[model samples]
Target: MSKESRKFHVPDALANLYDFANTLDLRHFTHHGIQHQQADELHNLAALGEWMRQHGLIERAAAPSQKTFEAALRLRAAVRDYLKCEPAERHRKPAVIGPLNAAMEAFALRVATIGKDGFALRPVTSDAQAGLSAIVAELYDAASAGTLGRLKMCAADECQRVFFDRSKPGTRRWCQSTLCGNREKTRTYRERHRHDPASEV
Candidate 1:
């Protein structure tokens, strides 16, 4: 599968479900140039719905709801805002978390059968935003424990991609260094040298 399609699988090291919410790519430098989910297809609504299921964000059996889809998209933006803020600053958003709480309450936990590692907390939720909520809870849990310090939005002012920092030092500063980071650096370099006398012939 393509890399965008492959983002649904959450690694054990990166266990937050909120990672799935912000699927839109906003790296484009111009207005109205952003895309939803970055589908390989033309990114029609139907394609977006199909993509959601393929990534396991929405269940396969349930017909996706329009309300739910809008909420999910809004929730994604709210999540981005929450993540970008400092821990102390996160409390300033009741509007951002209202949907999160709604989604969280819609879902429940079920006890699964025995395993070598004993019982685990498995989420049980149906169609609509319940699935979205289940993942939001995970992000909150991770953030509360301070383990999500590595989760970050790209440092580049124009890039809206969220990235997980797996660096040994937990100091990763860009979503993708070759893309937004390099672009920003190049812009800065040109600005710095634009005023230099030696550059002007």
Candidate 2:
């Protein structure tokens, strides 16, 4: 962690706190995320810091250390496991929150209200670890409040990237429609063709 990246800055209020919980976009060898998280990107602390900043987990001046980076990997693994559960199971007492709670406790956090209907979680210290924890805390708050409408894993078993369902009808089944969605659809088509007697090779 460098002072140049964490010494002075104001937290951006416009960022969606729940969004930070999705910092982990694990690589499945098929495609990259809206923010790439390839092995190289994740292994490098500086690149991890840059990704966090873009995702509103940390301010531009907030640098991440090796500890912060390692903690983040742990948190993401916990989250990814949690997302692998069925939706109904998740709504119940799935065994994933234990790790989530542990991850949330990594940093000190306080809820500060800006107005009658606006309050945000802030870290007690300027450390990048605090930023990571605060992001998880904010997500926990959102999930408990029922604001995280439809967080889901991709239907493609091999490409199990978790994503927030942003559809009007809430029918999104793939992490990315253009990529995984299309691939699955093409596979289905091939399967149908293989079964068709008239079109059989």
Q: Which candidate number would show the highest lDDT if scored against the true structure? A: 2
Off by over 4 Å in 1: 1-10, 13-19, 29-48, 57-59, 86-125, 196-201
Per-residue CA lDDT of candidate 1, range 1-201, in tens? 225323633344344343354465666554356543332231345655675666565667765566666665555656676666544556677865675555445446565556786753355655544555556556755766676666777777777667766678777678777777787899999999999898896
Clashes of each: 0, 3
| CA shift of 50, model 1, Å | 2.1
Q: lDDT of each structure?
A: 0.59, 0.63
TM-score of each: 0.65, 0.66
lDDT of 1 at 122: 54
Q: Give a tens-digit lDDT track for model 2, residues 7-92.
A: 31212321233233334444554444354343443557887888677665688887998887877777777766666666557656
Error of 2 at 81 (Å): 2.3
Q: What is the lDDT of residue 72 in candidate 2?
A: 76
